[model samples]
Target: MLEYLTSLNDHNLPYPDTIHPIVVHFVIAMVLFGFIWDVLGYFTGKTQLFEVGWWNMFVATIAMFVAIIFGQFEAGLAQPYSVAKSVLNLHTLVGWSLSGIITAITAWRYVIRSRNPQKLPIYYLGAGLILTLIVGVQVYLGDKLVWVYGLHTVPVVEALKDGLLR
Candidate 1:
């Protein structure tokens, strides 16, 4: 088991491709969609939209944790170069923070729903907007890690192996 775990591919991953991004994308979509649904529900007075938004937030809260777990595991295997290290560290911090934020937001949403399922408060909508912006920032940081830093890309891994990148 240890031997198999130690044997990593050219991307410095045990598996073929990164799983963190895949899981994280789901979390991002759910969060963004949830905010949109809540806003629409608030404006149009459609309670069903609130239901949809609640479910999305609920699932997003759960998925965020899963994404964090996979992200931590993949990051441990990333072997990021010096330039990528700072961005990776920031991404890690934000990811963990987002998980907490999402969970808290979901809990707040639950309380709101329990009190009034038909109408969402304006303050909650404001919080949703804030959460969406934070998610956008997180997405940008994540994109930087992959596009600019190329932490787990084939060429980057090869360069690291050849001692080209410090």
Candidate 2:
């Protein structure tokens, strides 16, 4: 069972890179750009940009869930060093919470888009800005997990295999 689970990270497939980061960049780009395009559309009265924002948010809503799934899978396999445990736990919590938050916001955006595709309400834009801010914080947390704590990196994985990391 342990061998089977560890084999999922074997890097033998066509896309050998970590799956979480691949999926997550899509979420990050879509959410941030979706908010940006919406704000620009609101201020400049460009209805076309609203279309762009709506689509971006819609795709981001989906991609964020995919990213969260891979994140949970990879995090489960991670054996972080003692000092890194709290940060990993926090990142996992935020990742799951962000998934739910993005889903709710996307549903709200869908309603607004369905009613009137051209104009977005100020409250919705405000909420999107807040969502973008939260995403930024999540990005920071993810960076700390990978860069500062070195989770799943080659060296870290080697250390784990050698029982050098707790």
Candidate 3:
């Protein structure tokens, strides 16, 4: 068990590729699309769009936890260097925070949906906007981890193995 656990691919992941990014992308898309749907529903007065938004947020809230689980596992395998550490830490923090925020927002949406279902309050829209902004910041931090720091990439892994990154 320990031996198998210690063995990892060139990308430093036990799996073939990074699952975190794959799952996180879905969460990101759903959250953004859900917010868009809500905005459209609010403007167009199409209650059906609210249903779309509600389902999206519901799934996104669940998927966020899955993404966070994979993220934590992958981060454990990342072996980030000095500069990448802070960014990785920030990303981890934000990811965890998002899970809670998304869950709370979804719950709030559920109450609104249950009570009226036909109308969305202005504050909910504002909350969606705020969530979108936070998601944007998280995306930037994640991008920095991958693009700038090159965490878990082939070259970075090779460099680490060669004792080139300290």
Q: Indicate which candidate wins on lDDT.
A: 3
Each prediction's RMSD to truth: 1.1, 3.0, 1.4
lDDT of each: 0.93, 0.85, 0.95
lDDT of 1 by residue, 93-122 (tens): 999999989999999999999998998999
Q: How well does each candidate superpose onto the true structure, as a TM-score?
A: 0.97, 0.90, 0.96
Where is the poorest 10-residue window by lDDT in model 1?
2-11
Error of 1 at 157 (Å): 0.4
Cα lDDT tens digits, model 2, 30-71, are 999999999999999998999899899999989988998888
Q: For residues 1-166, what per-residue lDDT tens digits would candidate 3 score against the true structure?
A: 8877778989998768899999999999999999999999999999999999999999999999999999998998889999899999999999999999999999999999999999999999999999999999999999999999998899999999999997
Better of 1 and 2 by lDDT: 1
Q: Model 1 off-target regions past 4 Å?
A: 1-3
Question: Which has the better lDDT: candidate 2, or candidate 3?
Answer: 3
Taking all chains together, the TM-score of candidate 2 against the true structure is 0.90
